[model samples]
Target: MSYITGFLTPVKTENKERYIESARKSWPLFQGYGATAQIENWGVDVPDGKVTSFPMAVKLEDGEAVVFSWLVWPDKKTADDAWARMQEDPAMANMDMPFDGKRMMWGGFETIFQN
Candidate 1:
């Protein structure tokens, strides 16, 4: 099974374009090192527990659109090893992160379905 790292975060709407451009630049950098990175932008059409079905997570003065992303690897061990090496890579040493890491939610997900 393929190993995957998932990242979920909020991105400033006004900064969305900039964020994606940064990601495009970064993705190839990782691909050169054998990691496949993919990004997705998410918008809430309804609050988590609401019934009226309205867009709740809009781009407010202090809020942002949610982003969900993933990094693909061949397997768990490969992912782990690659991540360790990536941490030590000088190319990533002083990277200017495209989003606010403090507000980001991320994790590894075990794949259960695929075509």
Candidate 2:
């Protein structure tokens, strides 16, 4: 089983490009530390349900788009270590976070199925 850390957030319309650029800049930092990250832009027709139905979780005052992202690690321990390093890295310091942490929702999910 692979350890996974999930980050789901609604990007501010005005800051979308800036946010993505910031994320792109930070991508290598994560890869260098032994983790893989994948970012997904939600579809307009995303259904409202247990996972996709996070209407209340969105932060934008008046927006319908959401960005769902996840980072995959070799295992939980490695993921934990990478995140710890990321916190201390100067490159990650003072970087503008793409999404508002307050408005975002995230969690670590155990891998149940993968093909």
Candidate 3:
């Protein structure tokens, strides 16, 4: 079974290119540390909710778009190890984020069903 790290981030609409480039730049870092793949999806038709929604969770603002991303790992141990090692990676430290990190939310998920 594979492990996954899911992420939700609100990036400024204008920074979409920068965001994609940032992800492209970081792919090697994650792959080097055991991530099998990285996927970043830019929201196309995300809707606002009255009570709670993707926008609400991230306190999305005008001129911003939501990014749904994930990293696929072989398993939990590999994922955990990669996370621990990434913190000390100099390249990661130097990587500039295109969005507000404080609003980003992430979690590790155990795949329940996959074909």
Candidate 4:
């Protein structure tokens, strides 16, 4: 089964273009480091929950939008290695993340089943 890294973040609505551009420039670095696939989605109809929600999870602010993303790797080892390498890669080091890193949430998952 493949390894996956999922991400959730709140990005300023006005910075959506900048966020997309940043992703475009960074995706290749991940691909070069053995990532098989990556997906980034901007929230369209996300609703707030009575007690908890995506917006609450990221401490979303006015003028900000939720972004959901994921990356696929052959396995955990490859994903781990790639992430470590990404930290040292100049392209990634120099790239700017358009969202608030402090509020970003991420995790790694082992795929147990897939159709």
Best by TM-score: 3
- Tens-place lDDT per residue, model 2, 1-115, is 7888887787767777887787787778888998766565653665556654655566445654577778888888888888888888888887878676777887878788999
Give all candidates' CA lDDT scores.
Answer: 0.67, 0.74, 0.95, 0.94
Off by over 4 Å in 4: none
Q: Write the per-residue lDDT of candidate 1 for residues 1-115, one digit (tens) a residue.
A: 6778887666777778888777776787667656765656565652543542212332223556667678887777777777788888887776666566766767777788989
Q: What's the best-to-worst order under TM-score?
A: 3, 4, 2, 1
| Tens digit per residue, CA lDDT, model 3, 31-101 | 99999999999999889999899999889999999999999999999999999999998999999799988
Q: What TM-score would candidate 3 get against the native?
A: 0.98
Per-residue CA lDDT of model 4 for 1-115, tens digit only, reads 8999999999999999999999898888889999999999999898998899999999989999999999999999999999898888888878989999999999999999999
Per lDDT, what order, best first? 3, 4, 2, 1
After superposition of all CA atoms, the RMSD between model 2 and the true structure is 2.6
Cα TM-score per model: 0.76, 0.82, 0.98, 0.96
Q: Candidate 1's C-alpha lDDT?
A: 0.67
Off by over 4 Å in 2: 47-52
What TM-score would candidate 1 get against the native?
0.76
